[model samples]
Structures are given as structure tokens and as C-alpha cells.
Target: MCPPYFSSNTYFSNAIKITTFLAQSYTTMIRATFLSILVLFGVNLLAQNTPYPTRFELSGGTETPTYAEGIAYYQKLDADFKTIKLFTKGPTDSGKPLHLALFSKTRNFDLKKLRAEGKAIFFINNAIHPGEPDGVDASMMLLRDLALHPERYPALDSVVVAIIPFYNIGGALNRSSTSRVDQNGPKEHGFRGNARNYDLNRDFIKADTRNARSFAAIFQELDPDFFIDTHVSNGADYQHVMTFCYTQEDKLGGVLGEFHQKTVLPSLYAHMQAKGFPSTPYVNAWGQTPDKGWTQFPDWPRYSTGYAALFHTIGIMSETHMLKPYEQRVKATYALLEGSLKLLGEKRAQWLALRRQTKAAVATQTDFPITWKVNREKFSETEFLGYEAEYPLSKVSGLKRLQYNHDKPFRKIVPFYDHYEAENVVKKPRFYVIPQAWFNVIDLLKTNQIQMQTIKRDSSIEVTQYKIDNLQTSRNVYEGHFFHNNLEVKAEKQIMAFAAGDVLVPVDQWRNRYIVETLEPKAQDSFFRWNFFDAILQEKGGFSSYHFEEMAAKLLEKSPELRQKLEEKKRSDEKFAQSGDAQLNFIYENSIFAEKEYRRYPIYRVE
Candidate 1:
């Protein structure tokens, strides 16, 4: 690693030597011409050493740097800040390195040491959606600016910043200027899908891609206090160039939730406003005017912020409007991040205190909200800057379509219903017993860094087991997983046997929220709800209606209670009385021969 200020000092030294040599060796006119050319080249070289001066600008704004160029820029900066260390997180689906840059004055990459020194970790992720390359360029500039003038920004002293220069490596490599139709002038940028064609954003909870797996490892290792994933937004046209999505506090839960809603978010926005970048919540509403208002964007676990919230880390999805000029978007992204650093630096102690409190509190939290309902009764009114939305006829499609009329822009107060009420809150169990057979769920839990132990020997324990009563599946393929939801489960208290090596996860830990949200059947993104246990919803065995008809009749004849029930059902329902198949199916479901394990969710909980 190069020592701090080595690049700057060396550049100046080289320039002076070149100038002196040129003046002595050539005539005045020739020397002046040579000196001017040499000076221009020297400045360009120094600018390269400095950050944010992109190759695109060097080329007179005709091109953006390739993914390799972005990585190389960071690597070069690594030399300027000796404390800055670059490491390959791992190879992506495209066999390219996922590089991370960690910076600190002490050159300490040890997170524990940094924490001991009263430093917090601020993790910034860029290029998740390669088309939204604003952060990629912005982060390079931010880190360079901080390193070049460490004394100028006191906030740099409060935290150790780690940045993933380009998260979706494959997407970043698939370059195209036309991919983002609505986006303004980057000249060229990456596509949104990775090599495997997976959207890494949606693969967080599922971990379907190598990128997500690597991210999981990094996230667990750092356990950052604050995180930001940068992007560009596509929504109703608005005056605000930058907007953001923080993890919904109501879903994050406990004091952590309160702190995020009441403190961090407001501070960041306020800071942004002070910087003149006037901010707004992410425009989650589509095909609607902002003046009509919208709700907070739901940051589910699949999203970066949502995953970060599982561990009670403050995470924000920073989005620059795609309609804005690329340079303006990049600058806006840099400004938002710069403001965030200031706020974080000013409130470092409070953030660290809240971090400790929340981590400790979550371990013992009794009730974890698995689902949330919008609290329509409570809302905050914010000024919304937007163009009038109009439905205009499409000349090609011969239909009216929703669009923004930029000719009629207006700013007005609009309701931002940010409040939410918890629904289907679950009383957390002491330990969750997952059968060893369900290794899929076990692997995922482990991937999320939830601690678990294996049963030393075969044992029987009384626990509550969820029987999946009903489930719904989407007709469309989502992120390569058959998504499921609307889970209806019947919990039964019973003694269950587990084999040696069965997974035992104690819920009283920092990952309690993650545990409950995933293990519980009703949670919006539970394993059951995500179709991890969809097999349980299928019955493998069933008696033929013709063969079981005689048995059902005999059973009804033998048992007076069965006979009465059958007679009552027939009398009450004309459909059942007329349909022999329906009667036989009902009898089969009520029979002992019906598969007991069908629709039986394997995860059991011990109180």
C-alpha cells in the first residue's frame, strides 16, 4: 500500500521536474508549447489519482468507464490512502471479482478494534442495479474526497467506511447506453440482470445468487451500524432529484424502530435539505400523481434495507431520479451520502448507544410483529413537488395512458401515510426445532447468520407444530422461486421426536426478529410463505373415489357419529348430496388413512 499523500506529492514533484527539463532543453516558444501539453497531461494524471474525474469527461463526455475501469479507479485510490484496503469479496456469476474498499486512518480492517476505538461502520453498496450507476461514480468520488482531505471532513474520523464498488458484477459488465430508456446521459451503463439473469436485490432473502451469498458473509462479518444501497428510481416525474427508502420502522420493531422513525431518517433528510438537494421519500406509487400522495415503500427482507433491518442496522436505499442528468444524479447521490456522514458523525455516540441498546433488547423481545397493516388514522403531510399526471392517447397503441405533464409542475402538501400498525404479531418461542430433513430451511437460516445448535442425540420434546392449512401461489415466476403467501396454519401442541443432528435454534438472540419472521408460517416472507415448505402442502397418497366409496359407506354404517354427520351434511348441502365424488372426498379427508404429514409444516417451537 502506498503511504498517505504519496500520490499527490509525487504528482507535483514529477510535474515540476518535467517543466524545468522542458524550459532548459527547448526554445521559449517550443518550451512554452511543450510545457502546456505536459501540464495538461499532468493535471489529467492527477485528476485520475483524484476521484470523481471520470474517463467519460476526459473523452469529452462521449463514454462512461467500463466496470473494470471503475474497479481500477478504486484500486488506484487504495494507493493514495494507505489505510484503504481492497479485497476481492469473491467471484460473481460472471467470474469477475466483487471488490470492496475499507478505509480508516489507523489502517485497521479489524472491526472489533475499530469498535473498541469508538468507530462505527458505515457500509455503502453501489451498482446493485447496474443501470443505476450513479452510486458507482459517486462512491469513488466520496471516498477519494474524504481520503484526499481527511482534515476537511471531521465526520470521516467518526466512522470506517466500506464500499462495494460494484455489487452486481455481471450486470455491471453488460454495458449499454440504451438499456435505461428513461435515464439521461451516462452515454453507457450496465444492464439490470446479472449473468444468471437474477436480480440480486430480490435474491437477498432467497440467496439464489453467488453475489447474495457473498453479501451475507460480509454483512454478518461487519454487522455494520449504518448501510446505504444506492440506485436510480423510475416513477412519477418530480422536481426532487434525489429520494430515498429507509426500512419501514414499524416492521423493524422495538426501540430500534422508534429511533429510525424519530431520529435517523429525519436527520438525514434535514441534512439533505440544508445542502439544497431537497429530498423526498421514494416515489413508490406508480401511474399516479405525487400530489395524490403515496405510502412508504415496503422494504421487504429481499431488499437491502430489509435484510439490514433483520439485524437492527440502519439502512437506506438512496435513489436519484432517472430523469435527471447523469452528472446531476451522481452529484445528488454524493451530496446525500456526504450529508449522511455529517449527521452520523455528529450523532455518533447516540447512534452507537442506540445500536447497543437495540441489539440487547431484541434478544429478549417477547413479541415480534410478523405482519403489518397501514395505519391510515395517522399520517404526516409533506410538500410534494410533481408534474400534473394526465391520461393521453398513445398514438401507436391507440389507448389512453398515464403520464406526467411536465409543462404543469406544481408543489403542494400531500399526505405521506408513513405509520403502520403491527398485525399477526407472534409471541416468540424459547427455541425452534427444525427437523434435520428440512436442510433447505436450515441452510437459509445459517446463511442469514442466525445461530443454531444440533441435537446431540435423538430426543422427544413437547412443542407447537404448525400444520399448514392453506396456501396461495403466484402464477408468475418471481426471482426464480415459486412465491407463496396467505399462509393459514393450525398450531397444535404435541410431543415430537427429533433425530440426532436436528437443528435447534434458540430465539433469544440478536437475530430473534429474523428467526420469527422466517420460521413463523404467517409472516409475510416466512419459509412457508416463500414456498420453502411447499411440499408439505401437497398430499402424496389418496384412495381412489371408486374404491373408497364402499369403505366410506361401511364406515358410516358402523359409526353412528359418522352416520349422523354424513346425514346432516347431505341434508344441509344439496351439492354434496348430488355429487358422489364430493361425498367420497369428504369421507377420505376425515379418515385415518388420509396422509397425516400432508400440509404439516416441519418447524416446531418450544415455549
Candidate 2:
């Protein structure tokens, strides 16, 4: 058994060593002007000294370390801090040892300990993609901050975080050289393939290659509580904010997914949204795996968010705003990472309870026939769901018609409770809009003097809401994409910019999310559920969907196409099915994101 150490301390150790080792790693390090240590050193000092280093600078620049280098870098530092190994494995790989590093307290690694503590986060970034240096740069700062303040945060106690910081050592070595430039910039920022020209992110659903065993072993060993994929936007379209592609708004949290969504994400978003760093919240209600799922075919990554719900993990995709300075992007990203850990630590009790209940629910699924509610009002619902991720556009689209998009998101509200038997109709109490805005939309409604009441039941909590909009005011008028509005919306270079473009509108649509009709709430209540396993998340509510694991399971079971695709993965990578490659790809697609590197390949069967 591997020894467990304080998770933050483990990080502190990793950060300190990476820098310390990189400074001395080689007699002749990469000497490209862009890959200098002076910048990293200065930034490290600033982060170490400043109460808040303004922004977190993760690494110096484009220096791709060998797996041996990365491992050795941390091992040396791990010796100094409160570091302990959580697990160790040697899996089959095309060329190397499948090394997996997990740093947490000895007690914390216990499944029972995780159950008792209840909050965890994982970050994924597969190698350094020329165009997507944000994840690499940002993680450098995050690692340092954790190392610097091991005792400052108790939240690290309830949290366990993992990072696939570098996946393509070979690819990074051959990547073009330039400053934070995308493929089209600075002479050296467009290369996007790993060493073998394989995209780690796309390889997940069926990552049958040299690194397959590494991926499998890691997945089997450290099934994280949350998965975070760090990547860049497709182009310079959006502003700087994290975007999510998975949810529990549709299903009941299949044993594990419920634990993260119900207990972790809400609190995490709330803390960051409240941090005074002007930005729009990013979340989605459905699986964003267009690669498979929906479009009729449906085989998604079983180790990523698609599997998160099944395993009770909260999956996140950290897509940085492309237009922003890489330093700023990295800073915001580090904060997001830090913020997530804080939420996990603070909500340990709730998360732990949810974890237990989620597990119990899955176990009970065999006898009780647990059902999930799928909202069919998809057109309006997609628009509604779209508001969170593609808002401002959603808001503009809805308002352009001068018609209030249906408050009810979906056309059909089908509860997935009893798929094998007669389904029960979900009783709608006049209106049901699970305001995807971390429950803040509830207050927005109250600000408008809306009539809404939060009711508490034994098993689940419900909010019965009504708007009292007597005046037809344009409160939601063109708010300039939320960037220049009363609230500052951080616009990135990629995503948010897309909606605002072509529209040639009066505002940068990326600045604001869907302008939900706000009538304002007059009162509030804690509709705590006593019986259902959901009440544990009363403080962090308003997720769009749930039960990811069940979603994956049922979908895989029902759809032969999806099953066949997944089966191919099992067959091709049978020998290395449980290696570090599985874990790496899981992280690559799910968390620890970087643009060019993470999204460079396709994971779905290209058939």
C-alpha cells in the first residue's frame, strides 16, 4: 500500500520540485528565448511573496519534460514536504513505465476515508500543445500555491486532486517555438499532436495505443471524485471563463455522479462567482459529447464525465478564454482550481453524506428500480440549457423574437424512474425552471419581485416559483454580452466571441449568459429533503442533470452502437486496459485542459 500524505503538501512538494528540478534538470536545457526559467523564477517569487500573486504562473514556458523527468522532479520534492505516495503501478505501455502519482494523506486515500471526507477534484492536461499553453502555465502557479500554503487551507483535507500535467513529452519536444501563440501566431504556436501525432483527448473512448495500459491502470487505481479537463477554445471567439460539458440536471445522480454534482460543483461555482473576479458562470445540463451520444450514436468516454455520474465524480472542462493574455488565462484557471478545492474542503460533510446516499441509491437500484426524469421540452430546453454555456446568444436568440422562451426548458418531462415498467409523470407545480445559475437566478427573480417559495420535503427539496412581473420592462436589454454591463463578464478569445460574431450585434454576446427573465423573489426557504439522498446538497443545488453513471450504463446497454464502440476499447486495449494511459486520457478529456494538446484528436470511433 502506498503511504498517504496531506494532499496539499503533496502538491506543494510537486510544485517546488518541478521548479527546483527544472532549474537544474539539465546542463543544457531548451534554450529557446520563449523557454526561459527567469520568467518562471520571478513569477514563483511573486506568487510566494504576495498574499495573492495577482495571477498564478504555473510553468516557465514550453519545456516538455520526460515522464522520468516529471516523476523525478516530484519525487525529489516529495521528500521535503508532507508528501506520501497514494498508489504505485507498472502498466504496459508502448515505450515506458506507466507511472501514476497520487498525493494525499494516508487515511484520506481509503475509500472509506473518501466517503467520510467527501470532496475531490482531478485535473488533466496531456502534454503541452503549442497553441494551448494556458493549462501548463496555470498549473505551475496552482502547484506553487499549494506547496506554499499547505497549512493555510483545511479544505485540502476533504479534497484529493490529480493532474495529468504533461501527456506528450515527445510531442512537446518537437512542438514549434513561440510565445503564447495559437497555431497562427508568433512563429511557433500551431502544432497540436502528441509525439506520435495521436490526440490523447480523442483516444479516451477507445484509447487503444502504446499508452493504453497506462490509461487503464490509472483509471482503475485513482477513480477521482471530480474530473477537470483543461483545453483552449477552438478560436479567438470567447472570453476567459471555464466551461462545463456534463450535468445531473437530467438524471438522479447515479451513485457517484450525484456525490460530486450534488455536493461539490454548486459550492465551487458559488465561491468563484462570488470572488469579485468579474466573470460569467459556465455549466451545461446535458452531455456535451457530440462525438458520440445523441446524433443517434452514443458511445462516450466511460472514464471521463460520461462515467463520472456512474462513479459519482464531478467532471469539468476548463476552457480558457483565448483572447486573454496567457498569464491572465493561467491566473484565472489556477484560481478556478484553487476555488474548487476550497469548496470540496468546506462541504466535506455534505459531500460525504451525498456520497454515502449515492452509493446506497445505486445499490438499491437493483431492487427499487430507480427512475430518472428526462425533460423532453428539448428545443426550449436546449435554448434554456444553452444559456449557461452559450448564453448571451441564448438570451439574444430568445429576446430577438420578443417572446419569452418557454420557462419550462423541455417539451416532454419524462422521469427516468422506471424505464422497465410504466413511467410516472412528473407533477409540475405550474412552473419548473431549474435556474442553472448556481441558484443565484432565484435571487435574480426575487430582485424582480417574483413570487417563489422554496419547499422542503423528506427525500428531496423543491422550489415552487412564480413571477410577478406587472411591468413589461426591458431589464434584459442588450447588456453588451455582459462584459461592459453593471456586472463584468470576462470574455475570452474563443467561445463567447462566436455568438457575438455574425450577429454583428450591439454587444459582445460572450460577455453575458442567457438573460433569464427576472421578476425577483420575495422570500426564500431551505426546502431540505429528509428522505431522498438529494437533501445533502441543499446548500449547493440547481444542477441541470444527474446520474451520469446510470446514463452511461443504460445508454451503453440500450444502444448497441455505443456498446460496440466501448467494447472495441476493451478488446483493443485488453492487455493494458487498466494502465496509466486510461487515467491519462481520462484526465486529458475530462480535466487538466490545454487547447491544442487536449483537443487535438478524436476519441469517438471514426466510423
Candidate 3:
């Protein structure tokens, strides 16, 4: 067995010096062979020594490390291990820097070089919601073990593991004991909201916070092949401790989606089951127990997994039940990470090939589904273990309230509605033109690495323009916006003039889905819905009723066609006939005096 002193920084520093001298003295081939032999020997010696315990292990898994402690531990590992590297990526809302810890067996940290060598990158994100800190602790232990015992994980040879030690640094810094009331263990945990009181998970697409923007920079840099975001579930009590939320396959679409649904998901479930941690689909059931049945949670582009899918990455969320012990949850999360790495290593070739093929196919694909709905007719039954739900009288309210009877556990077959069909589809355009005025939208597009170029000169091009016809907005605030939905748009061909600095985004690229979803006004999480184009939704100019009444009569007399349409509108719309202002306002709007920019979406599509 290796002595404890051999695992310290001094020992590794001396070892590096010896190896450097040998490499300088020997020939090229001899130096390569000698270095490989020395690396294997050093790793074996390190494996013999016990690894430094993680904060969770030290505390018996009842607590997680603080933001400072977690970063310090990773920094220590970065110093002691040759394969481990820690990088300061960008800033977060907490006024602290976000850190990325990478583990590569080949001692290579360059993502492009690894990709060129056919190595797959597996990314793990932790603590986006600090209340669910299972992944934070699990990742610390997992990475430590990987560094010490390289021989145990053959997958590291073909896969590079990149982990964001603490994603929401602000939330992690905001430690509390009373935030997650329903959670089982963990004596104390971080709050759910970050320093700015924003849920980081919901800010992926909008990127309203610095944390989300930093995540986008890291995500685009690695362009990982597989991704996992760890979380704790809050819902009805169930038998299983671990649950998973995979990116909706139909929304993922094409050969990549098929392979993920048919191959990757089943393998993960089986692997977890073999590891003695039986898992199920995320319990999306609300107002009822999961045994009754539940549909898969829809992960739109605002979510972590959903955002990853836009880049053709297979992403999953490992959600341990909130009712389970924190120790058990951490263990389950660790197992899932291990299983994912193994799967990535074994299927590296096929996964990479499929991703390439999918990107190639999407570049030329014409139609894309922007909206989706669950297909109840196409569901599969799975054996679910859940406790019986009962309505018991509440002592405080003196009314019946829902509660799960843990004593009455049962295993039964339940329908899992995993199939989703495209509710609305849109044809891909040759290019998307964005006027320079909407710089906020353009900035986010560039942040996500969507390729685009500025127009060389002012040009008038015939393009498809969308006029916002009808839409509904939430009466209450949600994520700092009046969320828009049920949108209707009318497209017309017009020769639109674009300025020299206007952005022209070509659709024939690997990020076509992202371009289509965000640029298309009707997509579920489009910028129009998120209020990026809210200025266009309101009319900047309006007619003065007293002055327009006389002008409206002159306009009506000048064009008989306008008069006929006004009469038809009055005959059909009783409200228009009853009000003098309405009649005059209608005429004023139809005249050339009305602003054409009103209710007109600025993004133009070239078909």
C-alpha cells in the first residue's frame, strides 16, 4: 500500500520533475513509452491510498459543502491529480466566478482536440437549485474516486467528464434550513432562488441572469455529447428514491431522438436497476398519485435538458425523491453519473455518428414542429410502486386535504404517456433577417453560438413577414414577464429594406432547430412570447377621434373599396356599428396614416 504522504502535492511535484528529466534525455519513442509506464504506475500507487473524504461523507451525508468549501476541495484535487483541471469560466449572479472541473484520463483539456480524437464529452451540472444539493456532494466524491482509481473506470479512456461543481453560486451561498419543507434529510441546504432571486433552470432561453449566460458560454465551449442535471423531486411520495426526466424524444426528433428513446434510456434504467436503485420516469402527476398515471414532463427550451437538446445533446435530469434520505439521494445520483459515463464510453462511436447525421439532416430539413401535445393513444405501461393517496381531514383547516398513506404501498402497472405529437409545424426558411434595433435578441443568439453575418449594404429583399394577429397573455406575472401563448400570425410576402448592420442568419447550419424555434414567432418559447418583440405589439400612434372623424369621411369618399370594407365590418361586428369613435378609428387605421410597424414582427424570413 502507498503511504499517505505519497498522495500529497510534494510527491507529485517530485514525480513530474523526474519524468521531465527522462523525457528530455530519451528519444521520442522511448520518452512516450516511459511516460505511459510512469503514469500507470503513479495512478496505481495513488489508488492504493485512501482518498480524502468529501464533506458529505465526513458529515455522514446529512449536509452538503458550502460554495467556498466545494471550490476549495476541487482546487486541491486540481493540484494533486494530473488528469484533473479546474477552470474559471465566467461570472455568476453571486458576484463569484463559475468553475468547471474537468477529468480526462489522457490529460487533455482541449475540447476540440478530444472531439477530433473521437472522444465524447459527458457534462454533469449540479446545484442549479441549491435546495437539491445531491449532485453537488455526489459529484465531489465521484470525481475524487475517478482521480484515485483510474483503473476502475475504463470509460474515462474514451470519455471526458466535465462537471460544474456549483451551478447557482448565489443560491449555494444562501444557505438555509427551512427552504425545502417537504425534503427529508440534509440538516441545512441552500435556498431555491439565486442571489437575484431567479430560478436558474427557467432562465436558460431568456438568460435573464448572469448565471445562465455563463452556462451558455460553458455549454457552447464543450458542446458535450451527453448531459445530466441533478435535482430533487417535490411531489407525491413514491417507493423509488431515484427518478429521471429525459428530454422529450419527439421534440428531440429524427434519428437521434429514435436512438435515445430506443437505446440510451432503456440502458440507463436497466443500469440503475442493476445497481439496486430502481428508478422511474419523473412523477409529473399532480392532484393525484403516480399509480393512477402521469404524462412525461415537457422540457421546453427554457429548461436545462431542453436547452441541451437544441444543440443535439442527449440530456437527462436525475431527480431523487424529496422524501428519500439525503444520503440515499446522493448515492443514487452518484450511481447515475457512473452509469452515464459507462454508457457514453461504450456507445461513443454510434452516439457521435448519430449526432453528426442528425446535424446534417437538420441542415437541409424543411419542416419542423414548433409546438407539441401528448398523444394519449400512444402510451406504454410500466410497473409503478407508489403509496395510496387518501383525503384526510386537516386539523388546521378542518377540511379534507390530500395525503399519501405510506403504510399502504402497492405495485401496479401504470400508463406512462411518453409519446408527443407535433401540434403545430412550420417550414424552414432559407434565411432569417433581424433588424439591428433588436440588439437584445441578437446578443442572445450570438451567446448561443448561432452563426450569422451582417448585411454588406442596405438591401430590399422580398421576404415573408409575420404580423401578430392574435395572442393571449397571462394576467399575472411569471418569471418577470407576462407570458404569451396561443399565438396567431399572418404571413405576407413583401420587399423589406434592411440596414447594413442588420443580422442575416442562414438556416442551413447545425443550429437550425435553435434558429427556427427562436426566430419563428409561433414557437412555444419564442422571443416574441418572452417579450423581446413587445414594442411591436403596441401601436405607437393612435387617431384623435374628434380630428379623425372629418378625415375619415374624406378617406372613405376617396376610396370606394375602403367604404365597402367598412360597411361590411359594421354589418358583421355589431360593436363597430354602435360607436362613432370605432367607425372613425377603423378608417384611420386602414389609411396610409396608420403606422405599418404596429403589430408587425420585425424578424423576416426568406423562403
Candidate 4:
């Protein structure tokens, strides 16, 4: 360029332009590469944070989240949102912290304070049977959505949601792929039994484990208006993905019962149906096909819902079908919970009033029913959607096996027998005097938070008592005890002396229903039926045939009435007539030598 005789200004200008072009090109390439990375990283972050079903689909697959994962989800929610607060109640049987994740607009987990703050409480217990882990995962997703997308769950504003993230932590930790063999699609799941191999659901009333005792404390502390325990059903295939086991209305009774039946349950079904999940009552019929008929499941205090009912809480056990895909089950469970919370929020005042009315009624009622019998004639009919079931030959066993043909779906009218009548009733006395010797029953009463006063002095009072006349005990052990059946009871009025420190359970309080149900001899699941009073059912003393021969004759002669009864028994029973020892034993049992306390119930009623 210099050789071409150009001016100094022109040469300088061409050099500056080439340098500027290179610098601009380099800067543009660097900026474009950096922006491309930012876009990719943002997409990855969005994918990771997107809530389930999307999250579950992208990462967790068809399997449920592990116990650790569930806790992490709660922890993350607490970290990310102002609405959630994470609490550790205590250590469970698995040595893991029993966690309760609370969701409220105000972020207050204190139940009493929350109630005072004008918020209705709704409690949820998940993974009760760890194998039925649908609720566990569903609950996590729900709380997340409620926090991140508050507009979606409008009902949460009026209610404080408390959830036991993993109710059966022991069972939840005992994970295996083959445990839930019947379930449709879960790579792995928790076992049914807790660490101690106990079923926590059945251990509720007994409080046999540390877990149950802790649960009792939690329940009494919260005193929630509504409670839910989630589960999965292993039964015949059906069209509906969701079903529920609500505390029986006939058993719950009074205004609370009517409210649940007429308003709460129907609204739950309607809300779920509107959300694309049709629901029904729990498939209570076990052996029978759904199209044929079904009865309401009887929930004893051993069950979670039944235990909640004693405290006048409206409890429902949500159950999803096991045959359905894991994703579908979880979604259905989430819908059920969402619907229930919405209904609870919408009718908070009515729920509060209903509970108040029930408590008032229970406080003054004189006669309370303990045992219930199904009213088969009083059933209502409903349309049932189910698959045709048949007994087909098993390919593995070469025997007829129960199978549901999902290919052949059918809908028909089915009998839904949900009504119940009190089979037995007990007069609610001023006080139930339990002797000091029955520490087992005493411990249970204390665990249930039943109000009891200890006697200060030895006192004799006229009261009604029971004598165990006959009972049939199971040969096998059930829940670490020998359960009884066919119990024959004889009531008598007696002047009984109670020592100091004896527990006096007054029936005038709110827990009157629980006291009567557990203490009354006629109640099906009473302490006596559970063999807590088994000592009363056995002969403490027996005589040898050689020693009691003369004594037997003398005893029979002393009481002609006893002799007549013995003769009638011998005449009727060939076995009694043939055995000499039987005659002697019968005479000995009738004689004064037999201890009166042997068959006498330790429980007495003071009125």
C-alpha cells in the first residue's frame, strides 16, 4: 500500500478497520456460546423443579419415593416456601425422625394456636401400611403444589394441613421389590410390618409399640377436626381408581355422624368426580364380587379411623386400587385428598358446630351403645362399575383361582349395606371403678387420654359387676394376645371395696364413648375380650380326685340346688357322667373353696 503512493491517513484508516472487524467477530462468537449454555442450564433447572407427575415421570419413574426422599421433599418445601414448616416429633422404631410437615397460610404448626387463629385443622397420616405407598408420594406432590402454585389449591387457605410424612417409618425402611407382589407397577415398595413385625394399624388401641404411643400423643395434641389415613386396596379389579373407608355413621353417631354421611362424604365424592376421578365407598365385600353386593367395613378402635372417631374426629381412610398403575393410583389419591380438604375448608363452621354438638350430646347421654350389628335390611342400592370376575384355572397351580377379567367390564346395581344398629348398650354410669390389679387396662386408659381419678381412701360402694360365665379363646395367638369369643356374662349388684390408688374412670367426660367401648364386658373388642381379664376366666384352684371325693359328696349334700344342677348336667352330658373327676370338679367349683375372684370382673360401676 505504501508503494502505491497512498497518503498516511488512508493507510492508518484501513489498518484500524481490519482490527475492529476481528475484535467484533471474536466477541460475537463468545457471546453466542455463553448464551447457548445458559439456555441449556435453564432447561435442566426447570426439568428438575417441575412438580410431579412431571417430576415423577422424568426422574422417579413408576416407583414411589423412598423414606429419605419423602423427608427430603418436605425439607426442600420448607426451605423454598413460606407456607410450610417441618417438624420432627421424635424417633420412630426405625431410628428415623417421625416428621410432620405442616402447611398453612400463616406458617403456624401449633395446633392449639392455629385453632385459636381461626383455622380448621385437617390431619393426614400416610404410609400406614408402607406397602400402600400411594399416599406417601401423593402427599409430597400435594404439599409442593399447594406451596408453589397456591392458586391451584384455594381450599388450603381456610385450613391448616398437617401430615405425618411417613407414619410407619419402620415399615417404610423395610423396602423390597417383591413385597407388594400384587401391585401393578412399583420397582420397589415397603413391607407391611413395622420393624418389630407389628401391624401399626392393629396396634392403635393396644399401643404395643413406641410408634403408637407417640401417635397417640400427636393425635391428642392436634385434635384435628378431620383425619385421613391413606391406603391401597388389594381386591377385585374395578373401573373406579379411588375408594374410601370413612368411620361408620352408625358407629360415629349423633350430629357428627349425620354431618359426615349427608354432607362430607357426598361432597368428597362429587369433588373427586369433577376432578376426573370417580370414587366409591371402600370395597368392603371381600369374598363377594362388587357387582353382587358389599357391606360397610367395621372399624374397631384398633384401626386408625376408629381410633380417631373416639375423639369425635371425622376420619376417612382413602384407598386406591392396587391393580391400577402406580402413577394413576398416586394421582387418584392426591385428588381425593384435595377434594376432602376443599370440602373441609368450605364448611369449616358447620364442622366445628357438629363437633360441639356431638361433645355436648356425649357429655349428657346416659345410654351409649358399645357393640354394633349390621342392618342388612336397611341397605341402599348403588350402581357399581366392575370387571367380570371368574374362578379360572391357575397356570402355576393347576387349581381354580379367583381372577378378574378387565377385558369384560360391567356396570350394575349393587347392594351397599352401610347401616348398623347397636347390638348391645350399656348404661353410662357416673364412674367406672377399675381395680389396681389391672395395670394393663389402666395403661391403655391412660394412653387413650381418658380422664381418671385415683381413689384416696378405701371405700365400699354398691355397684353393678360382671362374672365371666363362659368364653371361647382362640388356640392361636393374635397381636401377641389370646383373643376371646362367645363371651357369656352375668351381671350382679354388689357392695365392692376399692383400695386407694385404684383408677376411677368417670363416664361424664368427652371420652365416655371410648371408656364404655373398652371397659364394657359386652363390647366385642373390650379389654376382657382381648384377654386382659383372662385370669378371671380360669380356675385358680382345683382339687385332686382322691382328695376331693368325700368333700365333693359333702359339698353336694350341703347345697341341694347345686346337687340338682350337677345331676341335670351329668344326665345331659355323657362325658361328664363317665368321668369321676368331672363330678368332683363340678362339685368343687360350686363349693365355697372356689375363689370368688376367679371369675369376677375387676371392673365395677359406681352410680
The prediction achieving the highest lDDT against the true structure is 3
Tens digits of lDDT, candidate 1, 195-271: 99999888777777889888888888788888999999987788888898888878776677888878888887887
Clashes of 4: 0
Q: Give per-residue CA lDDT, model 3, range 45-66, as digits (tens).
A: 2212224556676455687888
Instruction: Report the error of model 2 at residue 308, Å.
Output: 2.9
**Model 1: residues with Cα > 4 Å off, grouped in runs:** 1-52, 56-63, 390-394, 397-403
Model 4: per-residue lDDT, tens digit, 1-607? 0011111221012223322333345554454354346446542222222332233433333767788887887887788788888988856688776888899886666677888877888899998899998888778877866776666667777799989989899999999888888888667889988888888888777677778878887888788899999999987679889898889998889889998999998888888889778788888877767777799889888899998988899999998888888878887888888888888889998898788788888988999887888997888776677889889899999999888887999888888899989988888889999888888788778866788899999988888888888888899988888888887889889888889998898888887888888888778678777777777767776777887898888877788999999999999999999998888878877778877888888899887
Instruction: Give the TM-score (vs. native) of candidate 1.
Output: 0.90
Model 2 alpha-carbon drift over 4 Å, by segment = 1-72, 84-94, 105-131, 178-191, 210-212, 251-263, 275-299, 363-607
Query: What local distance difference test score does each model get?
Result: 0.80, 0.38, 0.87, 0.80
The order by descending TM-score is 3, 1, 4, 2
RMSD of each: 4.3, 25.0, 7.8, 11.3
TM-score of 4: 0.88
Show the lowest summed lDDT stretch of 10 residues, model 3. 3-12
Best by TM-score: 3
Model 2 lDDT tens row, 282-355: 32213341111121111123224443343454666565555545545555566677776676667656655665
Model 3 TM:
0.92
Stretches of candidate 3 above 4 Å error?
Answer: 1-50
